[model samples]
Each structure stands twice: as structure tokens, then as C-alpha cells.
Target: MSRDGTGVPHSGGAAYLGMPAFPRAAETATRDDRLRANLRHATHTIRAKRARAVAELDDWARLRQAGAAIKDRTLRHLDHHLVRLEEAVTRAGGTVHWAADAAEANRIVTDLVRATGEREVVKVKSMATQEIGLNEALAEAGIRAYETDLAELIVQLGDDLPSHILVPAIHRNRGEIRDIFRDRMASWGRPAPEGLTDRPAELAEAARRHLREKFLRAKVGLSGANFMVAETGTLVVVESEGNGRMCLTLPETLISVVGIEKTVPTWRDLEVFLQLLPRSSTAERMNPYTSMWTGTADGDGPRVFHLVLLDNGRTDTLADEVGRQALRCIRCSACLNVCPVYERAGGHAYGSPYPGPIGAILTPQLRGLASPLEESLPYASSLCGACFEVCPVAIDIPEVLVHLRERVVEGGEVTIRGTRTTIKPAKRHTAERAAMRAARWTFDHPGALRRGQWILSRSRRLRPRRLPGPGRAWTDTRELPAVPAESFRDWWARTRGGTA
Candidate 1:
């Protein structure tokens, strides 16, 4: 999931290397009945469980506040926390590398692994790695990276990209997974045990057996931590299966590449997030595996450890006041699960490694609203606000979504040199902009608006129930509200002399 030196396409706005906007992508996805069904079932199940889990915690609000505060404080003092984190890792016999962006991060990790003289590395599902596209980068460097997580394994074997952050294979069903395993399993290390069934246990056992050998033989294991305790200089990974534990502890050299935003000020702050994260994400009171490592622990685990703190647009993201809250996200995917849009369109439609509501805002901020895909992402949401409510770190996803939309719409109006220019709007959103401009003009001139309303009322019978031209696509699936015979302004004018 390494980034291709060129910033990964921003979801929905700037199409990656010239792709269609979110509406077009979603229209295509909606046509895929299998994809829609997979998304519907997966999102609903996760959303429901998340709702129930959230309901059980009376202290949830406090916890959310605590999580937000910790993150805010850490980010506010990120430079210091990071330096502290580095010192701790070094003192504990670990190495620290700073990556300015994805390209550097990938190059650093690739070189680090190459230095180890290992052609293959086993990975714990890590978003940072995916964000930087470590797997793809490693591949280009002639190294093979194996995904040890079940869902990641499924995606890797199927030659597919992750749709959901937590459940990378959320777009895939059991049957699809079975087929992927049956078809592609042997090509990568150990084959699936014979007679593997799609039943959860059988499939899991086969994966376990397949990955166990790699875990033992691989000299390097790469991961992303859910939380990096800045004060204690420890890294923490919370996982549902024991696979993360295996990856974290197995290899002779462990490389953890994490976003700078993942740091927390103290261990106690970590305690608050630990409580909030599992329930918000996996809906578990406690995860099956809680692996924490403070550098190397003598002969117990990896003798050599390296922690890569990756920026990759984070500093740019931090520069935006309104959008910076997105940095608080814990990669919970609660927002993704509860997203109505995600349920229908699925993850790939978002285009970046991160998907759904969080991705809609975060990706564009991290990558900037430069690309067509980045520009399109801000409008991806229905603004349902479900994502904001479910976020463990209390990121205001909808607020950030709109903030980014503003950035996209206003990008051309302001120059990097602090001058102004008008960039042509995309062909897709031109009509939308025109309509909005017309509405603004009408609202500003009440007298003309009244006359316009009277005319519309007289011709109400001729009004089309469906939108015309570009809008027809929007109204095709959604019912356009029937226009009333008289505008609300007209009704008010007649009843109250327009001023009452």
C-alpha cells in the first residue's frame, strides 16, 4: 500500500491520474450488485454493533473528551513529544527515523529492510505502511511483503486494494475469500492447508498455518501502532486476533511506521484511548491481543527495532485550521461503518488507503486539494453526522468535510503567494456552482425574487418533476421534491403583506 511518490489520489475530488468524480465512481459501484450487497451487510453489522457498544458506556462522553484532549495536546506539542518518543526508543535500544513524506518513508523502510538482507517481510496490518505503499515499494525494490492479517491476506492474494480501514476485505465475502485462497494462496509462501473451507475457523486455521512459517522465518516484521505512548516511549498495538502479537514479537528486526498524529502525551492518556478505541472500533470491551513494546526488551523480542515517524502531508494537514481535527482520528473506522454513503458505494470509491467519512476529509487534507480526486472527496458525505458521533477521538468529520469542500471550491480564489485567481471549475461541478450562484443572486434581490416566484407559480404546472441535464442523474435515484403551486415567499407575501 505504498504511496506512488505522487501523492495518492485524494478521494472524490481530484480523480487519481484523471478518473471520474465520486458521483461517477459511486454510480458504477451502485451498479455492481455484489459490491453493494457486501458493503450493505458489512457496514450495517459494524454500525449496529458500534451503536450498542457506545450505548453501554455512560462515561463515553468523558472518554471522548479525554481522547480528544490528549491528541490535541500531543499534536500541539508534537515536535517535543516526537523527540521524547525518539529518545525513549533509542534509550531502550531502538532506532528512530524521520520521514518527511511517503516517498522518503518508503525509501527509508525499503533500504532498512534491504540492509537486513531479507527479501521477504511479514506485516501486521498497518495503515501507515499502506499510506506510504510499503508493499508496492518493496515489490519495486525486488522484495516480497506478505500480509499476515486474515483480511489483508485475502486482499493481497486477490490482487485487490483495501476498501475499509479495519476490515480491508470488507468488500469481499466469504465465498470470494475462499476463491482467492483457492486460486492464489500457494503462490505466496505456504499454501492453504488442503480441504480448506470458507467456514470461519477452517479458513482462519489455514491462514494461521500459512502465516506461521513466514512469521518464524522472516527477519523483519513491519507494523503501525494504534497508540505511541510518548512519555513511556512505548508502542501499543491492539488487535482482535493474535496475529499482531506474532508479528510484533517474532522477527529479529521490527520496523514500526506510524503517523505522527498517533502519539499520546502519557501512558495514562493511553489508558483512556485503550478504553475508547476497542469499543468504538471492534466493539470489543478488550481486544484479544494487547501488545506493547518499549524498544527492545533484551533477548525477549526483536533485538533491533526501528520506529519511523511519517509526515507525508501531515504538516500540511496541520496547517489548515478547520481541517486539522481530522488528525485526531484513531483509524477506528467507526465512521466508515456508520456511513450511509460508504454502505452503498463501498470503500474503493473513496480511492485512497483510508476510506469513508474520515477518508473523505483526511485524505484531501493530507494530500491537499490539488488533484481532481482530492477536490471531489469533500462532497462524498451526505452530512449525516454519524461519523462525528462515533469517532473515539471526537473528530468532527462533517465539519472537516465541509471545510475541505470550501478549500476545493476556493482553491483558485487564493494563490500560494497570497494573490487571487479564478481557476475553471470542473465540468462535473460547473452546473452545481451555477445553480448556487443563481440562488445567491435571487436571495439578495428580494423584489426580483418575488416576481420570479410569481412567474414560477404561474408556470408551476409546466415544471418538470425530474431535473434536467446534469441534474437528471442526481434526481434519477432520488425523488425531486414536488414544487408547490406558489413559492413560500409568495404565500408569506399574500398572508402578511410581505413584511409581517
Candidate 2:
């Protein structure tokens, strides 16, 4: 179990543990040609579209600031806002359930669906559901939850975890998808109608036909919301595919599982987020399907609406001053498209529902930084600031990454079999720490740094392409810099034609 400050034993987030550091995982991912090609093509295409979409908005900066401010204000009084939302939901004929953790949340949803005596439930693409592993929990309870979102359906059919937030199957190309649809679609339900080709329309038709059965037949529909309005107790979901519209409205029992952080103080606050989220996420001017329900409307959608306000390690994250900003994520995969690390390594390597720069900080925070895998996530970034630049809410992801790394190093005391002991900072990173400390000391004393530089220049010939000890493995994979005979100080002196 990964331990952060919460001291809660995490059982579900085990996927992000006991893995190699970023460099190793990235190396493995980069070698896979299919994965690389898939990621490169998807990211580049999305990035271009996102840039154009953002450019169209004249008040994008203002909208971004407004989104951030509203979130910050909501978070400041989150307890108050949540209570208000609960009241609004109940008044509007909805049952609101609070989940303290992932297990509780899954249990509530499972029981809710079980009460309806339905073995199969259809799902819209909801990150909150994935975060809590709702499908796995449902399966354990003798129920099967089907993902109806096109990308989610592909990921589900492939028996693979989501690699990208928006396009979960971004790691899969058209060929891979066609293969999945042809082979896997039949077993689930409404198999490909005769000959299903790789063409976009054919694929859409196959999926539409397949999902239409679930939409019409299923008793329960599960979804996650983009925002929850405290003022009106309305949950909003903006989607490209009309499938979300169907799921939200068609089911007899509609269950929405949402993160606590995805709340707004008022309906007006949604105005800002609506503008920011679509452009930042799908690169769309307006989402094709915008579904907002104030609890249950009479003679309209689902008569029974269940809203699960899920904590699931969110309070722990909120406790972090630096990391709490991660909750500001509208899940606009804009950061994923621009992240160099994600482009090369893809999303599966992060081993969480969330991926890319946001995932690096978010997974570690939610799951805690006790395991090697969680610890490695913080170091996954190049600190290029590209993610921050593109962020609609302006979350400083690099700052959070650095902050979490410091926490990992400093806050590693754990009781092993009742004996409290401090696990030394990751064994591999000790040399890095030592080197950094030495550099810091030299930099602090200019005279010592100058002398060290001169000595390094004199002993340039002694430098090896590969370093000794554990560092040798690092150098073996990377280029060693060629030490110059003359140091920067000497070069500057020569340029000036003067010497001490």
C-alpha cells in the first residue's frame, strides 16, 4: 500500500507501485513502434486543432482566469458548497450519497444498480467511474458494466486501460480499432452489422448499432459530470458524441459518480467553465451534446437520479497546498497533447486513470507517494512549462511535480511490521542528491566554483564517456559531454585578452 500523509492503506491504486523509474518505463514505451506512431499522430492532430480552437476565443485569457477563480472560491468553501448541492439535489427529487473512499463509492453504485435487479448497466465515458474502478467492482458483484463511449468501448473491448483521457484508445490506430470491433464487438452485444470496415462512418455505425441496444434496453445508466452546480444542484456533462445524451436521458435509473473537486458555487460559474472546457478539451467551440439535469425532471429523463459525491482520496489531495491545484483539472487533455513525456511514453506507463502531466502529479497525490511507481511519477516531467502554458485553468504542474518529489524524499518514514523506520530516499537517486548538494555548495561559494572549474579543465583528459558505479548504467544509455580543455572563465578571459 502506498503511504502519503493520510495513513490510509490504499488497496486499489496498486497498479502504480513497484514499477521502474520514468526513464526505464519511457525507454520501453518509446521502443514500441505501434505505440509511438499512434501517440505521435493523435497528439499532433489534436494539438493543431486545439491551438486553432483556442485562438478563436477572443476572451480566452479572461475565461481561463474566471475558471481558475471560480474553482478556487468553490474549493475554499467546498464543504459549504457540497452541502448546498446536496440540498438542491434532494429538493429536485434526487438521492445524494456521499462516498468517503473508492471502496465505499463502488459499493454504493453497485448496490444502487443491484437494487434495480439489472445485471448489465451501460456507461458513458466518466473518469470518476474509472478512478474508483466501478466496472471491476460491478463485475465482482456478478454484474457487467458496458462502456458506451466510442473510445471507452474500444478500450473495454481490447481489455486495455485508458491511455489518453479524451481518446482512451489514442494508443490504438484505425487498424487496431477495426480489428477490435470485428473480433470483440460480437461477444459484448450487437456485433458488427455484417461487414464492418475501418472507415470512420462504418465504425461509427457499428458502434451506434451496438450501443443503441444498451441505451434502449439497459435499466441503469452510469455517468460522470464535468461540473456540478451548487446553486441549482444541476450536473452538467458536455460531450461530442450524442451517445452521452442517450445515456443521460434513456435509463430508468441514472447514476452519476462525480469527484468532489468537480463542483461550482453557482450555475453562472458554469458559463466560464463551459467556454474553457470545450476549447481546452476537445478543441471544439461548443460541445455537440451538452446535457444538464437539475436532479430528475418529471416525465422527461430518468425518474430516479442518484448523485454520488465521491471523495476517494480527494480530501488528502486538497490538504496539499501545491498538489491541490491538480484538482483544478477540467480533464482537458490539452496538457497530454502538448506534453513531450506523454508523447513518447504514452499514457499506460503512468498506470492510472489520469495520465500525462496532470496524471504525473494527480496519481501520486491521490494514491500517495509511498511506492516506487508513485514516486517515479513526479520525476516524469521535463519541466518545460508547456503544460502550464496551455492549461485553461493555469495549473502550475511543474511546480506540483517538484513539490511532490520533495515530499517523497522527506516524508518516507513508515512502520515496517510495527517497527517505525525511515526508508532512505530512492537508492538510485542518492548519487543525484549528493551531486546536487556538492553543486549547491560550489555555487554558494564563487571562489570554490571557479577553482573547481579550473581543475576540471586541467583534468579534462581524465573524464570518461561512462561514469563509474551506478551512474555508469545511466551514462551507457545517454551521451557523455566532451569536457573542454579551457573552462568558460578561461574562454571569457581570452576573449577580453586579460588574465588574473
- Candidate that scores best on lDDT: 2
Residue 393, candidate 1: C-alpha displacement in angstroms: 1.7
List per-prediction Cα lDDT, in the order shown. 0.77, 0.80
TM-scores of the candidates are: 0.82, 0.82
Question: How many residue pairs clash (N, CA or C atoms closer than 3 angstroms) in each of the candidate models, in the order given?
Answer: 20, 0
* Candidate 2 per-residue lDDT over residues 409-441, each given as its tens digit: 545543332244555676556655655455557
